[model samples]
Target: MREFVVQQNQSHSVLITGSTSGIGLAIAHCFARAGHHVMLHGLADNETADALRAAFAGYPGNQGFSSADIASEAGCAQLVADTREAIGNPSILINNAGIQHTAAAHEFPSDKWHQILSINLSASFFLCRELLPAMRAARWGRIINVASVHGLVASENKSAYCAAKHGLVGLTKVLALENADHNITANAICPGWVETPLIQPQIEHIAREQQIDLETARAELVGAKQPMARATSPDAIGELALYLCGDFAGTITGAALPVDGGWSAQ
Candidate 1:
C-alpha cells in the first residue's frame, strides 16, 4: 500500500462522483489523504458541500466539490468540465454515483428504470468519454466503477439495478480491453451490504419491526445472502479503490472484484 501512495511530485487528479457522503465520500477521503488532487461531486446542498470540502482542508491534496447532476449527456459534460476547471484533468475517475429502485420487473416504473440506467451506467460512459482522452495523452489513467454485488448476481425486485450494474461491469471490461496499450486500466468494484448512510433507515426499520438491536438487525440484513453475516465498511471499499489506482494494480484491469463478504461466492 505504501507504494500506492502518491508522492509529492507525482500527485494525480481524481474525480469521484457522488462523493458528498456514504461510500463515495469514503473514496474521496482515501484519495485526498494520499495527496491526490480530488474533485468531489454529489447532489449535496451548498452548505453540506462546503462542509465536505472543508473536512479535506488539512489533507495534503487539494480538494474541490461540485453538485452537477450526471444523469444526462449535458450533465455529464458539465461534471467533467467542472472537474477540470476546479482540479485538473481527471486521470483517475471513480464512477460512484448511483440510485436504487426496487420493484418487480413488470411492475417497475418506466421512468425509474430509465433513471437508474442513466445515472448508474450511461453517466459512466459519458464521463469516461470526456476524460479518457486526457488520461491517454498523459499515458496514465484508472477508471473504477462502483458497481454492486448485483452486477455478478441477481436479487429479487432489483431488476433495474441489477441490469444497470451488470452493464457497468461489461463496460469496464470493454474499456479495459480498448485501453490496454494506452496505460489506462478499468475495473469494477462490486460491494455487497456496505455500511452506508443509505442503509441506515433500513437497518432501523428492521430493528423496530423485529424487536432487535441495531447490530442484530444489521447482521440479519446481511446474513440473508452473505454467509459472513457482516457488512463491509465503506472505508474498505475506498481502500481498494485507492489501491487500484496505484502502480501495483496496473495489470488488474477488466476484473469485477467483489468485496461482498462471500455473498457472490455463493
Candidate 2:
C-alpha cells in the first residue's frame, strides 16, 4: 500500500472519497504531498483504514478514516457530521467512489444499476449539496468528479456506469454555473482506462473468457483507440486534480477533461 504524505506549511484541506485504493488513493497522496490537510475516505474498511492511518501517523496534515456510503441520504448526512468534527470543512472535494458491471442493457440488474447510480452520481450530488454551504461562505472551493471515457462515449455492456457519469457531467456544469460568483469550480476527469482494482478482474475475466493473453485482453478494449495504446496512471489524474485546485486553474470549471490518451478523439 502506498502511504500518503503531507508537505509542510500547506493551507488546503481536501476530502477524497474512496481513498483506500486506486485513483482515490493517488489523489489523497497527491494532495497530501502538497501539504494539504487530507481526509482519506474509504468505505467500511477498518483494516485498510488502520494501515492508512499508520502511514500518516507522524505526518503534519494527514489522517485516514472511513466514510459511510454517500449514496444514501443517511450515509451522506453522517459523513458530513463526522468530517466536520474530524477536519475543517473541505476546500476541495473529489467524488470518486464508483462501481461497475458488464451486462447487456435489457438484462442489466436493476438493483445493480440502482447501486451504481446511487453511488457514482447521487452520492456526488449529495456530498456537494451538503458541503456547498460551507464552501460558499468561504468563497473558494474545487469539486472534481471522477468520470470515465464512458461518460463521453458509450461502449458495450456498461449502461449504468455510462449513464451515471453522463449525469455527473451535467451536474458539474450546473454546479459550476451556480457557484461561479463564489470562486467555486466544478470539473470532471474522464479517464480512458486505468489499471485499478476495479478493472483488474475485468481483465482476468476477459482473458479467460476470450482465451487471450492479458496484454491482448487490454488491447482489445483500447485497440486502435488511444494513440499511446496504454492504460492511464492514477498518479497522473491525481496531479491533474491538484492542478485544478491550484491558483492557475482559478478560471477553469465545468470542463470534462479527458485523460484518455486520445481515446475520446478517436
Candidate 3:
C-alpha cells in the first residue's frame, strides 16, 4: 500500500456502507485516520461490529457502527436518519456495499437478481435522495460509489452484478451533473479483482471448479483480465478513495476511474 499524507483540517462526517470488512472497512479507516468522523454501516455479528467500533475509537475522530440493512428504500431512509442523528449529516458518502451471485442469465434466480439490484443500484439512489439535500445545503459534498470493472465491461455468469454496476456508473454521472453548481462531486471507482472476503468465495469456487490449487486459481483469475497478473490490494482502493475526497480532486467529477491494474485499458 502507498502512504498518503492528508492535510489537516476540520473533521468531515463520513458515512460508509458495508464497512464491516473488505473495501468498505479499508475506506472507513482511511477517512478516520484523516480525522474524519466515520460511521460504519454493515450487517455483521455483534462481536465483530463491536470489535471494529472499538478499533475505530482509537482513531482521531468520532467513530461508530450501524447495522442498518440498506437493501430496501425504507432501510436506506432509516440509515440516513440514524446517521444524521449520530454524527450530523455526512459530507462524504461512500456507497461500497455490494453482493455477487454467479449464474448464467437464463438460470439466475429472480430473487437474487432483485436483491443484487436493490443493494448495489437502488440503495445508492435511495441514500443519495435522502442525503443530497443536506449536502446541497452545505454546498460541499462527495459521493463515491464503489463500482466494479464490470461497470465498464462484461463477463459471463455475472449478469446481475454487471447490470447493477453499470446502472451505478450512470447514476453517478447524473448526480455529478445535477450537483455541479452545489460543489458536490460524484464519481465511481471501478476496481478489478481485489483480495477481499467478498471475492474469496468466488476464488475458492474457481479452484474447486477448475480443479486447480488455490494459488493457481488466483493466478488464473488475475491473468484473465488484469495485466498486472495479481489482484489489487483493498488498501489501494482505499487510498484512491481518500485522494478523491481530498482538495486536489475538486475538479474531478462524473468519472468512472478504474483501479484495475489496467484491466479496463484492455
Candidate 4:
C-alpha cells in the first residue's frame, strides 16, 4: 500500500455524491483528512448516515450528510442547496454515484437503461450545472468524476455503464475547457476492478455461474483485464483525488486518468 500524506495548510468545502460507502466514501474521507469540510450525499438509512457523520467527527473541518436521491435534476439541485446551507458552497465536487446493469444491448431492459443513464451520467450534469456558478464566482474549484475503464473500452454486457462513463469523460473535458481561466479543473478517474460493494454481486454471480470458488472467480475476473491480478483499492483512488485537488495539480485538467492496474495497456 502506498502512503498518503495530507498537506497541512489548504482546505475547501467539498461535496461528494454517493459517499455513504465505497469509492465515494473513501474520497470524502480524503478531503476531510486534509482539513476540508465534507458534505456527503447518498441513499442511506438514518442509522448509516449518522454513523458516517460520526466517523468524520475527528476531522478538523465540518462534516455533513444528506440522503438525497441524485438521479434527477430536482434532487441534484436540492442536494447542492442543502450542502451550501450546511457547510457553505462546495469548492470541490466529486460525481461518484453510479448504477450498473449488465445484458446484451438488445436484451437490456429499457427502464434499467434509463435508470443507469440518469444516475451515472445525467446526475453529474445536473450537479455540475448547479455547482459551477459557485465555483466560477469564487474563482477556484475542482470537479472529479469517477468513471470506469469501460469508458475507454467495450465490454460484453455493460452498454449503459460504458455509455454513461464515456459521456462523463466528455463532460469533464468540456467543463475543464470552459472553466480553464476560472481556476477550476475538471477531470475523470477511470478505475478497473475496484473492490467495492457495487462489484460484490457480480463477483458472487461469477462464482455461482462459473461453478468456481470465490477466490478463483475473483482471480479470473481481475485477470481478464487487469494485469495487476488484484482489485484496485478505494484508498488509492481517494489519494489520487486528493492529489488532483491540490496546488501541485493546478495545471492538470481535462485528463482521463486511468488508475486501472495496467488494464488499459491492453
CA lDDT, every model vs. true structure? 0.92, 0.84, 0.90, 0.89
Where is model 1 more than 4 Å wrong at Cα?
Answer: 1-9
Backbone-clash count (model 2):
0
> Is candidate 1 or 2 superior in TM-score?
1
* Residue 257, model 4: Cα distance from true site in angstroms: 0.6
Model 2, 40-133: lDDT tens digits are: 7867567777888887666578564756777798888777776766777787889988888879999999999999999999989999999999
Clashing pairs in 3: none
Query: Each candidate's TM vs. the true structure?
Result: 0.96, 0.90, 0.93, 0.93
Which one wins by lDDT: 1 or 2?
Answer: 1
Residue 86 alpha-carbon offset, candidate 4, angstroms: 1.1
lDDT of 4 by residue, 1-266 (tens): 01112422357889999898899999988889888999998999999988988899999999888888888889998999899998998889999999888999999999999999999999999999999998898778899999989877778899999999999999999999999998789999999999887777777899999899988888888888889888988999999999999767888999999988899889
Residues 153-194 of candidate 1: C-alpha lDDT, one tens digit per residue: 999999999999999999999999999988789999999999
Which stretches of candidate 4 lie above 4 Å from their native place?
1-9, 204-213
| Most TM-score-accurate candidate | 1
Residue 159's lDDT within candidate 1 is 97
Off by over 4 Å in 2: 1-10, 205-217
Which one wins by lDDT: 1 or 3?
Answer: 1
Better of 2 and 3 by TM-score: 3
